[model samples]
Target: MTRPSDHDHAPAPAALSADGGRADPAAPPGAPPGHPRRWAGLAVLSASLLLIVMDITILNVALPALSADLRPDSVQLLWIVDVYSLVVSGLLVTVAALGDRFGRRLMLVAGFAVFGVASAAVLLADGPGDVIAVRALLGVGGAMIMPSTLSMIRHLFTDPRERATALGVWAATAAVGSAIGPIVGGALLEHFSWQSAFLVNVPVMVVAIAAGLWLLPESRAARPGRWDAVGTVLSIAGMVALVYAIKHFGKEGFDDPGALVAALVAAVALPAFVVWCLRIPHPILEIRLFRRRAFSAGAVAALCTSLAVAAVLLLLAQWMQLVEGYGPLEAGVRLLPAAVGAVIASPAAPALAARIGARAVLSGGLVVSAAGYLVIAFGPRPLSYATVAVALLLVGAGMGSLAIASAVIMVGAPPEKSGSAAAVDETSYELGAALGVAVLGSVAAAAYRGDLPASWLAERGVTGATAAEARESIGNAMEIAAHAGTAGAELAARAQAAFTTSLEGASLAGGVLLLVAGVLVWVLAPRDLDVSGSSHH
Candidate 1:
């Protein structure tokens, strides 16, 4: 099978124009000949996406340095880490709608400028509050950039086949960015301040802004009706509440009052938002798109894949750093198998889907990921790095199906609704990741605590506050063990074993979840679905 090259010179389908309507063959001289620089524009969009995705993970490596400099309390530290995601989730729908109403290129350029300015501003961040503010600003920029990239791609690549290949490159870039964030952050922090983790975005954004303006074409919804302020408010409230509640639940469990209240807000606001969108002629989001089986299946595939992978990847990173005593950079490099697998598989997924059905590729990817998780869960005792590497490779390969998911989603919607389609697609990813970390992370925490019971801790003179801290997480347990006398070695060893057990339990749960998701997607997605065309069926 020949792979589609970036220089695909296929003519646009005569039946479908750039706007997903019938083309006019009798057009007069100098009619819009479509963007000649579209492939170059895609490169700019991918670069923007890489930076935005990288920002999400790079902070993990910078947190220690930032915390030591600012000496923030626990709550402040959590905010520093989480505020970015919260802001991004909240603003995604609203920002995407604005991009459609205004121009996607304009939104994207402004986003680049904002991201650059915010990163440079980190130099003046002396307190936890200042850092949190910068992170929130960066989230705003990320929200503006994320959906624009997808919607712009829909406009740029009118040919479904070319769009699929472009999306494949987009997905591959995202995977690489996410995997390498920590490596980049670690490298920066070793030589410069923690601020360097952020400041690095400045130069890249500068170049992206220039390239984007030069290479990207301006596009927006042709018939964008009046703005829905109520929908905007509800969307912001619902997404923020939903994400905050999930994070709170992950940290404090389901019984926390704050989490419950946030969940209530999400439940109320999201339903109201949906109803409002259905009523409005020009809804902030095209909620009706979910009625399409292909679109819905694509969203489910994105959500479940992210749900199954996020927590496991996070835990593996922690396992490398905390249990194996690898430095941040070393741990990041060890985590690269998934990235390597994704990079190799993503670009090939579109071609594979073209040969096999889209449904097969999407559902099969999830099955492959399930196998990866099951390998970790049921692999031999005392799992080695080699086993983990193999599992990561499988999971990464499975992630390549996301390119098909994106294609199905974009092609399923009309060109005018691309912003909404992009927003929904990205929302699935954000919400799925939050759900994964909350649910599976909680399961892991429970398993860890169950293994290190209070009674068992007391028997080892690790009672009261110290025992509670040990029960909380392996990181805390290791810290306590470091200060303990001779018994510290035994305690550390037991904690490590317990953490390993918890990881296995979580892997089992994630594996089962992925298997269920795979079956559901297979059932939901049409057997004859062709992603290389605009028609859903």
Candidate 2:
């Protein structure tokens, strides 16, 4: 009759302390059974790694164009852009644990196959419904890809230093993937159709699938736990509700009925799920992991970084093309400095951490990021592309360093829980991005309203109900008002001004968050980088 919590259990070393420190447990006292195929395996794994990361943000540059072509209503467009992340966030923990239960390489190869077919589905989609369905399926594939890669790395490299170096490379590829999404999408959209963006994934996925089959080594859970169906449902439902709630708050504030309902549902469900986790004999995600200080710190940092930078690519794409009138490709080309900076800085992070301490490097990077945000926030009324690019490079540098924080979490976690740990990290990253778009974008919308002239609505031929509706969709409204003669011209100017002010406010808020995160990291992250067996390779 006794509950699970009543069961006597010996805690892990980290679990016994207040700070909940980690212990190295990946490699046994004896050396790992060395695989002669390690080199080819690592290469194949890394290459396959790039595609999953790339898919996460590659569609951003094409969103505006896609919106026009599809003529989706406001909600539909947001889903078209956000469903991928939302689904990915909700399923990461479940999928990661599944990979651990099944086999990492097997899951990875299966993931590639699923991702390829999903990408093809996206390419062939003729309507919004089709695209959305395909995108959701892509998320399923992505959930499989993410944890498998990290867990495979854990099994592949036994030496902590080599593992750290390999993770740095892995982290760099992730950063590069985010950067490449826009550039590749921009180029493909400019020269070909929007479908080409999805199409490009096909070839990359094919390569990964083939390479994985040939070169990747197989590994799975050393001691697997039973899948917790109840926990899985609660986690996914709670996440979906929470994201919807957050999005609702951004769009309609605290008072909106939809927001209220969603928030309440999430509040109840998430806590209930946590209780369920503590009670379950085998939870899908080990809730006890958060008790680790390093894991907790890393999770917070990851979320903060993504929240602060989520709007960067999207807003920048708008700043470059919509406000400045640069073509998609031209805008992406101009943004290359930041991409270059991120790529260069990403690889150098572990080395930097070794010298200055992970705490110092991460904290310093956050502070630098705050500075970048301020530069963008207070820049000239009609922003200069060059100035924005410079600020973006600083932002990129900040992000580059932030990427290493994952290594901290992974290395700090017990190797037995590597897949779950990585899954948690990836989930935080995805959640941050989704929340950033929803919250920051809302802030921008509010600022736009305040900046607009009273006459602006009348000028655009949007009066009464139409004007109220138009206010809800500044982008679409502005586009419609742009070609309406003198009145349209005035409306366009007002819309532009509104959007600019909104952006400025969002940037300022982001700046403050970045600074706070810096302080937190400096104060909370452990001084020593003694992550060994605790982290997966």
Candidate 3:
């Protein structure tokens, strides 16, 4: 669905080797091969990635205040949070295709402008509807910005070794942004207002826009063929339905009929989209990449790890804020260990892979992640911060494995196909985040209800509807506790205890999943897989 353009500001194509295959796009005519400015371009792309990741986590701490200020009902509140992700996840493939057809830098620059405007528009938002609309706008911008980051990296660092290193740094920055989201949000909320979270993006996006203009070069797919309009529509429909299905399952659990119907829709639409992609000459996603065992193994590894950690990180924030009675800032600061682990491990992933091989490194990382989950699950009562910190360290450190996974994904494809490859990688990540929150979060929520002591509530003289309310969520129990007398205090205590038990059970379940994925990666990822060699005929 791209409109052909006469604008020809795009950078000249890099020269190919005599083999007539894809060559290093880093080199332009009359300029030495692999220009040093490419590194600076990498910096710009990484900055964009950091900003988006931070924005996602930053909202978590601001949601309550936003709700209070806007006075949104439950459905509106959900939309305020859910709409952005739905929009981003649904349109990623389409936008990435646009980037390929038109220009990567063009799409990226437009995204920055759009993101900056949407974020600043929040300053004028006086109601839930306004905020939701702005959030949806930001999602379109985010969808455009995200895929360009990886694909640009793929183009900028044509040397396999340099690309691997760049990817590692990019991965670390991404993890850091996610870990620091609460801290940034808490810091802003403490000094400013809820709108500050959205406003903060304005300045960052401004800087990104300026830097991108100077540093980034325009690139596009050399043979981006006819736009698959029907495929694009199907992808959007399927992904949106899929995200909704996951959200519904997370909120209402498996018994909800709405979730069931949404799942049915997703089941039909997604597979149809996949079949369409396979039959087409030009697809938004290169599903054929999964035919490579190394690529498939790495993809599965990334998805599994993301599924486990996404939920744990989410619940950990709440555990710190509500259960442990820490302020948002303190909770965010305490979570720094996870960032530290990522910083250490991500940069080391390439070296580890070089030494031990992709299969071993990927599998080892998964095993370490599973251990971290187990540690958190089995931690002592009162949820010791020290124990959780260690688990966070392990979790973050283990994500270094994704560096290798990412390399496999990118290297498996030729330079011309990087956009589709990047889209596929991002899609796996988005799906992982969705599934993690949906399935693992649902397990924790179910366990929370199961562990809620109905008998204990009765003994405290809080039964029936009140008891059910207490079991609904920690926030509800806290609201009840604030208004109720001594019985309310007892109810809140029981509810917190139940949530803790539930979290532990969920962590145990995630740990088992990682362990199984680790085994699969070990078996399926070829031991001799090398990123540098994948592009050669």
Candidate 4:
């Protein structure tokens, strides 16, 4: 079987400009002059990306306040957090395919409208169920927005090098959004209600909807074949079931029959979905792209980086607030080292890759991140903020390589398959986050429990339900400590110590995972891979 060169996958003749105009005929072959408003349009897309990424972390900061107001049980609280990702991950391939069939611009605009409406609807949410519904709607909106940004970038920047730069900016925006989410949420919670966090998205989204329509061009697959309805269903069912199974396993381990059933569904449906895609002419996703070493390497880099960072970041946020006794805003500020490192490194990654090689940058970044995690696991002393800050900086700097990963994935694919490529890239991120939290979070939780055994709690006069609660989480233990007098102080100290120990254990595990992924990617990625050119060979 002869493989097609990247040149064979160039933008279709029908692709449009940023102003929804015809492509420039006078432009050079394989490197057309992009839309006049391309740079400005990138700003609009970056803003949208910022909000989408920020929403996840903002909820983390707002959870305590929301919990106080809604008084949701553990199950409901879990639903409120997990449902958004569930909906987003399940719908990504379907929505991205729709964008390619319809118009990327239309999908983006609609996503903005949906996001704004959902954010505003938070005002009416008076219960946990209402908030959960609102989150699901936001997930729908997020699903629409994420891939469109990447696909649109592929359209707007015809030059592979220029597109790489744009992707670097896009990656930076995502890093900033995640880094600042807690700060924004903390500020909102300080001045207003937990509802304010959701409400804040309304105005920005309204503006984004207006700007996106004006700035973004309408582009779609010039010859998108008939929709693969079966493929869509299988993809959705497989992803939803897979994510659900992971979440359930994390929460309940292998003892839960429901998790096992969900895992079974995912196992069957996913492989079947892959076969269905291969058999179809116009599959919902471009499954064949994985044949390219660069594309596969990029996907692996994104997944492993997200997996190594996500759960640790979430745990650190709690560590700052609960163990170190920092306020939300202060903790958010302290967390800035990671963001700062990313901001500095993201834009520089492409340039760095040019001097070295894409393979080195991508694999080296993961190696750096693994070092950061190892630092956290083996750093000096009783775990101070200074030690954590250094570790965060290293980790964030390492994440900058994702820009290279994105470029490799997008540039490696034909423009006609941009939507599919983007969907795959985003899916890696979403799945990685889900897996990180589930797998690494379980590790941390088990370690925490192991350190604070029920027997120890019982010996400390925290018998029955209180003892169980203490072992449940550091947060619950601290809450009990707030009112338990002398015993309370002892419990708080022990719980904090246990949490710190668990964080170390989880970090060590995550570090090992990252090291292994780095080695794999290093072996897989081509030594001479050039992200600026559309050639794998």
Candidate 5:
């Protein structure tokens, strides 16, 4: 982390209202000054964000290839899949604060360097252990990049409308990246090798780093303080414990003793950190930001929407590949309707919000999302790809609206807190995505297990096997059962049926959650319908 420059000194709380909300417009404190290369700077920032967000889903299509190549145990496979997000979520707040205290531009360049190096490491990784280590490094690099981009944008675009337009572009990148990752990964997996996925980031980051160095201006917290080392440790520990407990519950059930202990640790650590913050002259995480109604509502909405969307995307990919037997390329192509719709909706969100109001946009989006889930839950049995496509289109549209609502949260806040605000929003987004995958993945797995046959062992002609053996060889059991004649065929069909039934139930639950979210958004978001030019990319 870069050291705080001499610019920081004693200042009053940044013009926040008693409720911790910004009562004044988010204008720059001085006359609007132009940067020689602001547009190039914004582009570099956008590229950085696109690379990090896109990576979130890039590995989805590579899971089978990865498993075959790495030959990891189940536990290793889980970590290989989740450790990037786990580490990223744990470190976001601490890293974001570090950037604010030091310099956003310096952090951006350093982060890009780290990401490029880490990507190279992952591509060259010889085994699962190496890949996991590289992924953790990528997470650290991502932690630095995310907040810097938002803070730079906060500093770059001083006008509210201009800022909203910039943020709209930023939000569009996220939707586009999410939409494109699997397709890109699939193409790479088919024509080249899995290593190509990591290699691709090299060029993107290189361009971004060069442009950032030439164009981005230095910006930092107006009244920086000493790096809060103790606060950083407490925050990471609390987040890791909390997320680990949640992840453990999804995997081993809520009753697992280890998960219970993790949950307890999280409970104690999080509050203790907050109390510690109150005592510190300069805290790493400004927990007081939550007092802002718009900020608070926006953060919660971002988390909820992300959680719902991540779960849906994961399950949908499984439905297409495992259940429907679609090839990687074919499945990725089928996802285009949703991706295209989201991209189209994303750019139009600012104008739409201007017409209907932010609260209405959010509430309406949630309603559309809930309806999409209902369509999935009640769609014809044996599944129709067309039905799935249409449902995703609706879900994508809804997500576009929520993205705009979130843009408002930052646009309306004081500029000094922009990094912190963006940090909070981004944190919710990543954490929500992680929880979504974990909770939904676990539910889906349990459903798959429940749907499996008691006759599986008998069909294989095995009375018993060691726990590790059974877990590792579940796929072999299915293959064996399929070849064992009429009994095996019946067992296989029953298992498939059970899994599909579980998917239907999960979709229905998702619909209910989206509906509840819609109601909350309607009740909680601000009534003002106008767009301010205060937010940035």
Candidate 6:
């Protein structure tokens, strides 16, 4: 990571109470931006973020076509799906460190070049291995590009308030990318080959490169010491293992030997890496940043917000498609309310943070988001689109608190250390998303199984083994029902009812979890905290 200059020391704990946060609490709202070119730079940054975020989901819709063309085995297909994230998660801290030591602009441009070239190469992929290789390359490009954009934003907007506002716009990109990826992928696949999915990134990367070169400024740590190569390796291994375990746990549960092994390695390696960072003179990242209330509070807010969004969004998507019988495209379109809410809330947050303080905004937003979940939980049976739309909007608005989360992270650290801070913030987001699926999904599954009629089904041929298999998932349950003849229809109808009830319980639990998180943040964050300027008190 970026080496700290003498002046780049961590903000003193004592000075924090009086010196840091807000330009001035008594002052009126909204400060001007840090630089004349910062907005233009933000456009470039947003595009980069959009591409990286979109890549994560765009592949989901194209998977069937990808399988048809490449004819990947099931195992190969799983690898193809898992490898990109594993590679990206592995390389994040390493790339962020390189971005700080080497110029962030240089690394970003290089990332764009790699991404463009790798995307274009997909046209030549005739087999699963070829596509897997391309995905790995794209992951490297993503790791390089993602942190560069965030750190660059830290440099681009020096004023804490302006930076917070800029970050809000940046945070909205996540919502927008999720909302758009399916639509864009669907449109592309309708008229072109599946390769078009990858090929599309080429032109966008080109535009991003040209704009980045023109609009972005170069930045790096001023006095970076000897690079910690060992720490880099440890971080890569630890994160890769952690993410693999998380993804595996979400899909196959915790019993798999591979997942257990990965989780063990991650649990061991991560703490060792932390200890390594603490002992070293010029560490990979300042792990101590977590000690600060603003930083920790914001990180918690970001994580919990992501957990709520990811888990609820999964259930909501299934409800809209499977339960409500909407087409895939229609369900995706209906979910756009969340994106719209985020777009509005993101840019508006800095002013709000300026007025009531970021602590309140962060905590308050989570509570509001929880209210949305409550609406989902207790709304009239057979879900209503109007009610869901309103709920999605609230969820999105609450997630807009991520703007404050980003600010607390970046503002709490020195500009030169932006890469490390960005990596931490980004990791929190990814981990939260994964955990949300694993935890809430497991909860929902239990509720579904519990609500199912057990003894009645056992008397039929659908006893023991068959019933056990059906209870595995809603999709499996429906599939089993479809071929079970007359008796199965009743089972299928009941399964649907049970699944819907599970969603209610899951939504309620998720809402309560978010409320608890909001309370924790309310206690952890300070009331007078300000990010109006540099917070290195």
* Candidate 3 least-lDDT 10 residues: 1-10
Candidate models: Cα lDDT each:
0.76, 0.68, 0.73, 0.78, 0.66, 0.71
80-169 per-residue lDDT for model 5 (tens digits): 656776677778877777787788899989899999999888757989899888888988898888777777776876554344445545
In the order shown, what is each candidate's alpha-carbon RMSD?
Answer: 5.1, 6.9, 6.1, 5.1, 6.6, 6.8
Q: Score residue 440 of candidate 5 by CA lDDT.
A: 60
Show how many residue pairs clash in every candidate, following the order shown: 0, 8, 0, 0, 6, 2
Badly placed stretches (over 4 Å) of model 1 are 1-31, 34-40, 60-83, 120-133, 153-168, 189-195, 210-220, 250-254, 414-416, 454-469
Off by over 4 Å in 4: 1-37, 67-80, 124-130, 156-168, 411-418
Candidates sorted by TM-score, best first = 4, 2, 3, 1, 5, 6
Task: After superposing candidate 2 on the true structure, give the runs of residues whose Cα lies further than 4 Å from its correct spot.
Answer: 1-30, 123-130, 159-162, 414-416, 449-455, 464-475, 528-537
Which of the numbered candidates is closest to the native, going by highest TM-score? 4
- Residue 506 accuracy (lDDT) in model 2: 86
Alpha carbon deviation, residue 282, candidate 6 (Å): 2.4
Q: Write the per-residue lDDT of candidate 2 for residues 27-94, one digit (tens) a residue.
A: 34675543567656767777766666556556767765765566555445556666777777778777
Clashing pairs in 6: 21-530, 22-530
lDDT of 1 by residue, 1-537 (tens): 001112222222221113323333443345444477888898999988888878866776665557546765434544675566567766777887788789999999999999999999999988989998998899889888887887788678765445545655676678878788879876777789888989999999999999998999899988666777898899878877876676567556789999999999999999999999999887877899988888788888888887777678767866776678777677778878887777777767767777887889999999998888999999987977888899988888888655567667765666656657767777777666656766687777778888888898788888988888777767677777888888799888888989888888999999999999899888888888776553654
Candidate no. 3 TM-score: 0.85
- For model 6, state the Cα shift of residue 373 in Å: 2.2
Query: Among all windows of ten consecutive residues in candidate 4, which has the lowest summed lDDT?
Result: 1-10
Supply the global lDDT for candidate 2.
0.68
